[model samples]
Target: MAELKNRQWLLAARPAGMIKESDYRWNETAVPPLKDGEVLLRNLAFSFDPTQRGWMSMDTYVPAIPLGAVMRAGAVSQVVESKKSGFAPGDLIQGMAGWEDYTVTDGRGMLGLQKLPPGTDPLLALSLLGITGLTAYFGVLDIGLPATGETFVVSGAAGATGSVAGMLAK
Candidate 1:
């Protein structure tokens, strides 16, 4: 319970053009003991991308963040405390945990009870093999439906997914 008193960064203001670190604020919150089906997790690492800025925009994603809450960021974390079934300490997970040293979540929207793939570095997944890979894989071959050896024109051509899509198209 004393640990919950530690601080975190909440979304101080929704970004206007970009998410300068100024658009966020530090939150000192209590790390309460878990009630049924809740878990306390220690923040590890997270992924950041351009679409996250879009999520800040009222036009693109869900409602904009109200000032003074944890800024929107995805995270990989470890369970330090749990009151849920089928989960325990030391379990690694991924989800939108925000910018905090610790977080308490009701085990939802999380994936990964299994270890990350061998040598498939999660950071690489953050780039080449993660969301970027999915974006590239679906964009060219799925939605756009390129024929064999057809030339593909791409915007953001040097970006994470576009580069992969261009290479894949060749």
Candidate 2:
């Protein structure tokens, strides 16, 4: 196969309310050579969540992605090359790989590199079994703490977390 180029969507500016495509600047960068203990991942899909907007804000659980930085995102990707022990070519994994089509990692803290079982569905990995669902599960069960027969209120009832929260509430 031909050499793979890395394509990325960078945060161009902070938005006031909702985000638009113009808020991002697309650019291609050279994929760097692998270093010892590093693995190259080819991103397959990204999760669009409300927290992404929060990340665009001035403050969040993590520092906001800086302007000109690749927009922060969680992705499902396949290992394309590996210098790491547990990760090998063709292994599917989940992590915070950002908006780039490719990412390189040495499996450090919070990068949260997790290898999926063979034949595991990427859709499931990106959804019900992913952060979105886990967030909903915790937010509803732990944080919300609604008792049986208690009414549950979800503000963004149409969103991924909200929908899961709603169902878990019911």
* Global lDDT scores for all candidate models: 0.69, 0.86
Show the lowest summed lDDT stretch of 10 residues, model 1: 109-118
What residue runs in model 1 are displaced by over 4 Å at the alpha carbon? 109-120
> Of the candidates shown, which would achieve the greatest TM-score relative to the real structure?
2
The regions of model 2 sitting more than 4 angstroms off are 1-3, 109-111
**Tens-digit per-residue lDDT, 1-170, candidate 1:** 45556577776666777568887676676777778988888877777877767655554545555666676566667788888776678776556666778878885643333334445455664556566777888888788788876667888787877888888777
Residue-pair clash count for candidate 2: 0
Clashes of each: 7, 0
Instruction: Pick the lDDT winner.
Output: 2
- Write out the backbone clash pairs for model 1: 4-30, 4-31, 10-69, 10-70, 11-69, 11-70, 11-71
Cα distance off (Å), candidate 2, residue 139: 1.6
TM-score of each: 0.79, 0.88
